[model samples]
Target: MSLVDLSWRNVRRNFRLYTIYFISMLVGVVIYFTFSSLMYNEDVVTAIQNKDNYGKIIFIASIIVFLFIVFFILYANSFFMKQRKKEFGMYLLYGMKERQVATMVFFETLFLSAISVSSGILIGGFLSKFFGMVLMNLMNYNDDISFAFPQEAIISTILLFTLLIGIITIQSYLNVRRVQLVELFHAKEKMDKPLKFSMPFAILSILLIVMSYYTITIAGDTNIWNDYFKEALIATTVSLIVGTYLFFRQFSGWVLQKMSQSKNYFKGNKMLWVSSLRFSIRGNTVNFTFNSLISAIVIFAVGFIAVDYAMKGEVVKKEFPNHFAFSTQDDETQKHIDKMMNESHPIIGHETITGIQTEKISNRKTFFSYPEYYTEEFYLFPESQLNAIVDLRGVGEKVDVEGVEAIVLTRGIDEPTKYESHQPEITVLDDNTFHVVEKIRYPLLSIPTNPGGDTGPQPSVLVISDEAFEHVKENRTLSSFEIYQIKDPKTSNDVSRKIYDIVMKTEGAYYSAYIDMYSIDTESSSLILFSVAFFAVIALFALGSVIYFKQLREATEEREHYAILRKIGVGDKEIKRIIRKQLLFVFLPPLILGLLHSWYLLYYTVILVIKDLPSLTTIIFSVMGLYVLTYLIFYVSSTSIYYKIINEKNRR
Candidate 1:
């Protein structure tokens, strides 16, 4: 038979062994292709105002995904090559030339890569449309999306995978040529030892991870956060990654060693299995730690996106209960805005609210001496805001802040502690002295605030009575806002655009007065949410596939070990039990750790965004529950395949 024909036949013959590998590769390709489709989509590009920035982000993220895929493929191929060593050895023993055998590996790789690339592109083409629908939902947008065949994305996928196939082919050729005949025959039986590290280093690894978490939590409390937020982010990010790597590399293996050392723990199948697990060339500490880290990242990425997207909906509902808010000085401007909005949207009703804002004499005073680094500003709403606005919002109820009392509106877990000391005293505008009633969060309205002082609006808003507001109105500049409730929600964009044109093109429109809470139509918000979500999903699938295939690839090497155990008087039942335990041990660490990591992050996100956990807790748990089910499936499938391989000899 021709070498190419033989290789093709071998691929067909080993379809079972190649299934998971093929599936994962296909998934990776689909992810890349789908993303490419979005990246090159013209309609989407023109629609989003932040299109250029999004393109830059996609460019960077795509490179990351590409490099990651290459590494994953190479790593997976290494395990496959190990499994093929015996086959290669037998071929050489039967008088096949090394170059001919290597040529076979090359052909096999090329054929498989072609199948993966082609099928992935075909499937990706169909999925991209469905994905568009999903994106619109996630973004809370109401725009119709038509599916267009993405030629650029298709070409990109083809070229990328084709190049990978070429690289794999060359790698296979080199591997087969260098294979030592004796070593090839002995490869499966050989074991690999975990890397040795000192106790101090292990301790240091734990310390590093703790310190990294501390750095992230303490960032807001530091004076330098305003000036060095970007630097702090970079530093914290590096620390988190390096610390995780170090912990897994040095500390996790040490933990397993300690578990083994326990006299009571190591017995019967446990002793044998634990020893086997710790000593296996395939399940070495490095791979275990690396895969765990990958799984953790998958959890974090997915959770981050889920919470972000979910909270955005909450933000719009709570923060922007009204359709549009236009703050204008001229009553003429108000008329123009009203007409423009009415032309686009049938107005159900509108509210003209007046409030006092002070550029000067609007500072909040703290009672206690503290660090020099607190900048989440507290703003005032006139007493009329409580009876008129806050009453409508139904959040911060009138608390009888008659003369000497003020309530600090707490957002979430993070807000109550903004002050360094407890029971902070506040002197509003330094003239109205009020003892803190209690710090509480009331999401009465969603007005965008710049957290840092770089932006004028403060995050915290307090409500006083109309009497108190009227007293202070003359002291500060009076501003008015016309908040309109529109009947047709989908027409928000049209209304916003008309108002923008009026404010921009019309003569004598004040530069400072502007519209907000309406400018963010569903389409723009949906785009932002879906874009982040898509990146998270792509990362998650890629990482999950890698870990699953990594485990599956090792099953071939495990078969011989099970055979030896059965020969040494271990019953089939006992072997099966041992295998279950072994797999559970390997699976749980990464999965559990990743969940905890994601949980902490999600909580942090809630504090900043929605601030209330009860609102999003169900959704958060549901996403996590889905992940657990998916990862559990991987574990079960891997174990079943491994078990079947170990006992397949009995069937014969």
Candidate 2:
């Protein structure tokens, strides 16, 4: 009878149509609330050693999630408004004023937002603890996280959703006020405009995409990479973006146009779906392009996170082969460290190597310049002591230095010819010189002789024969280091912390404790992996919803056409087949393009850093398989709903 009653009744009648949209909004709210809660969560801040840094990361991720939720809500609202244009027209024909109809629309939005937001916040609060536990478990932490519902989080969620609700209501009101009865009734008949095809633009799109891939693949090998890497990267990204847009806008339409002209266009019901698909693609080109790009990003992100998390241990081990290492001048401090470490954890291997610190080194006529530490002052190690430590770690290449020849150990130099010129002659005390023979990138020590201890680039070490090492050690003031390999060093954070405190107290002391770097990296990487995974899920959810809602809207528009086909002797089976072909055309292209883009992108980027190609491939394909499975679920769901809508109209 009244506007409120009419709005409520319409909502109840159309509840089935709103189910997917409601669920999507509910999940978006839950994700937003859960992540926002973490920003101010006391449990997370207290559990993590660096509270400020953790808060900052969660804050930034929450903002991104919030923006995505806004986009999703607005998108779903547009679909709903389009679907109900006829209903609004009927209301206007029944003596309802435009302002009154707009009010009714506003009430409907308020009702849905109230139900979804309240229920979502309630569910999100309970689920926050589960996500917290997941984060802790991934980080290898054993701390128990208690239930916490931050008031700030609740207030923020309420305020943000309230603002979103206001925006949705305003949009609905404006749309209703501007609609005329004839336009509203005929809105669904306004089909997409035909595409203007051009062969040159289509070919250019393919060429641009190829050029972008070529640039990225050769980025590491070219002088352009060394001089203008940033510019090259920007150019590659721009080209890829433009190329993808053109592929969807021009190339896809051209192919459809060619298909229409071929004999295959009239093949049993092919025209039914093919013609529909052309129109759909023409209208949805921008949407399809965006979905393709987001899908690619999600695929690459998931693969990268999985690979990075898997290879973190190997990376940590390469950087920190020794369980504990420190350089100290005092013998008493070294003894105390050994005693303390031995008391806490059993030392599996230990070595006290003597090193000579000297600045007398010079080079001539080299194509590549070495690091300042390599050319200026550096540590000199005896071949025997280095071999002993190498045996202790059971890794790294041992050097064989003869006479005045020396070996250089460093990393990050890839070109072999850079070290072929006149080798550096290490001049020690009393004018002694050793010619450098071979260069290696193997990491053998933690400290880089810089102020950051083990944080800088791997420092170069000069390895010489025992006879030369002795001569230099006797003449120069020697630096002594105690290296230890302990059992289960990753689980020995407390012991590492105590030892770090002791080592820091000694003046001119440099140390590397495995647990410090390992735990921090583990925690940070796991958090990143979790955040990236959540983002991928959200993006996938958006992609699926976009297609699903779009299909439903089109189905509503084409119901009359299907009814006519049925009356003219078109069987349900043939119509269903047409539906299947039509929906597949919409669903399959972006997914295939996304898969190819991600595979190519990861091959050039993540695979270089993570060299275990086979394992990385397995992980990447596994993620893609899961993505495909999820997408198929949406496809099947959309097809079934579409058929049901058409069947009901045919029966009527």
Candidate 3:
């Protein structure tokens, strides 16, 4: 048979073993095609106001997907090449020329790549419809949805897979050329002792890790200056990655050595287990490190997406607590507005704070704040207050605002303590006299105050008195209005429409003041929730499948070792125990690190999304729960596959 036919038959016979790699490539293609389809969809094109920007988002997503595909293909292809070294050697020993052998290798890769890519694209085309439907549902795009195949996406997929396959073919050809026949034959037998690092390097790695953590913490808490803080975070992340890789490399050896010194070294299979694990880690340290980083990022991304979705619900509730909160510039629409409000919801006790705006042309400055802007002195408003605002128009008795020019603190304000200090500065305007008042703590009602810098509006200390309001409006006209909170939050939209109609009827005298009820749209929040859940499922599946398959490939090489141990009178139970231990060592560290990083990331991300982070207990428990469930599944699946391989080898 020709080399190409030989390679093809071998692939078919070993299809089960290669299925995982093929599936991964298929998934990458599917994701790429799905995203590309979304980007090129005519419906999406029409929906977005800024089509160019939408196109850019597509391009960016495509680029990210493409890079990931390249990395995954290259990594998996390396393993494939390693697995086939013996075959390559056999071909060379049969008197095949190196150039012919290289050509055969290239042809084999091209055949496999072509098959996988073509299947992926076809499957992806079908999946694109499903994905589009899901995305549309998540975004609340409910207007007459129909899936149409985008020619652009098809073309993009073809080009992308063509490039990927060409690269893999070249790499296979080069690898064949580089390896001598003897080297290829002995590739499976070439085992090197694990490298040991001095204590100083281990210490340095730990130090770097510590520094990275410290830097990230500082970055998280730094004042919201754009340039400096961004650079610091980027630097910290890079340092953390490098340090983490070095630590894994040296730490595995150090751990094995320490275990060897222990009494447990002679008990059971502790020594074997430790040695195997250390070898596995040392053998694939770079791969392990990169995998860890990828896992960490994936965890962080999933957590952020989840928390962001949850917070969107909270945002909507806070922004529109009651139905039809309205204000108007003119009194002519008052009766009509009241009628609309009454029709929309059962009116509870309605109250309005009226004030005239005058420009304080002398020395006063306008300042505002939200929960996020507060120092430790400003306690976030109690949930009860938010509930009351939503359900009952009664401001919870806990909030007390005093005189005109007094700070209308939304929540309680305490003096700054040692741990938390405030940067309270007063700026004098050229025309108006401004006074610093008690800071307010309200549920975030708008875009979160920029936490990274002091660029946006600070929390407001409401100067409640009409006199104080007037003092700040020198050149500005005094505009008077009322904010009415209604009994039913859901009816707020209907009431708003009624008020708009009234204001339209009143023409010149009544300008319908804009009250953003975007937050009241539960659909948006629901969509966000769906998107998070979908992506989380995808990420976990991808991570588990990739890791499981990679480990399975390696298991083939270790099958002989396990069989030899069995022949040497090691009990099957002991072998299994060793497998478990090795698996634990291989799997546990990345999870621990990823979870730790994810927890911290989620904590601050929550702070960014909502004014207050979730309770520490809640955050910790939720994260731990996710970790245990997913990790356990991964562990069980991986161990089962490993043991199965060993058992099969023993039988042979």
Best by lDDT: 2
Clashing pairs in 2: none
lDDT of 1 by residue, 121-186 (tens): 888777777776676555445566666557888887888888888788778777877878998898
**What's the TM-score of each model vs. the native?**
0.71, 0.86, 0.70
- In model 1, where do residues sit more than 4 Å from their true spots? 40-49, 91-100, 146-148, 193-268, 281-283, 301-322, 325-344, 352-481, 488-491, 510-550, 564-573, 597-627
lDDT of each: 0.62, 0.78, 0.58
Clashing residue pair totals per candidate (backbone < 3 A): 7, 0, 29
Candidate 2 residue-wise lDDT, 62-89, digit = tens:
8888888888888888888888899889
Error of 3 at 630 (Å): 4.8
- 200 Cα displacement, candidate 3 (Å): 5.4
Higher-lDDT candidate of 1 and 3:
1
After superposition, the stretches of candidate 2 with alpha carbons farther than 4 Å from their true spots are 1-3, 41-43, 95-99, 126-130, 137-148, 193-246, 257-267, 301-314, 327-346, 359-377, 411-421, 448-460, 475-478, 605-614
Scored by TM-score, the top model is: 2
TM-score-wise, the better of 1 and 3 is 1
Model 3 misplaced stretches (Cα beyond 4 Å): 1-7, 40-54, 95-149, 197-243, 301-363, 366-550, 569-574, 600-633, 647-652
RMSD of each candidate relative to the true structure: 7.4, 3.9, 7.9
lDDT of 2: 0.78
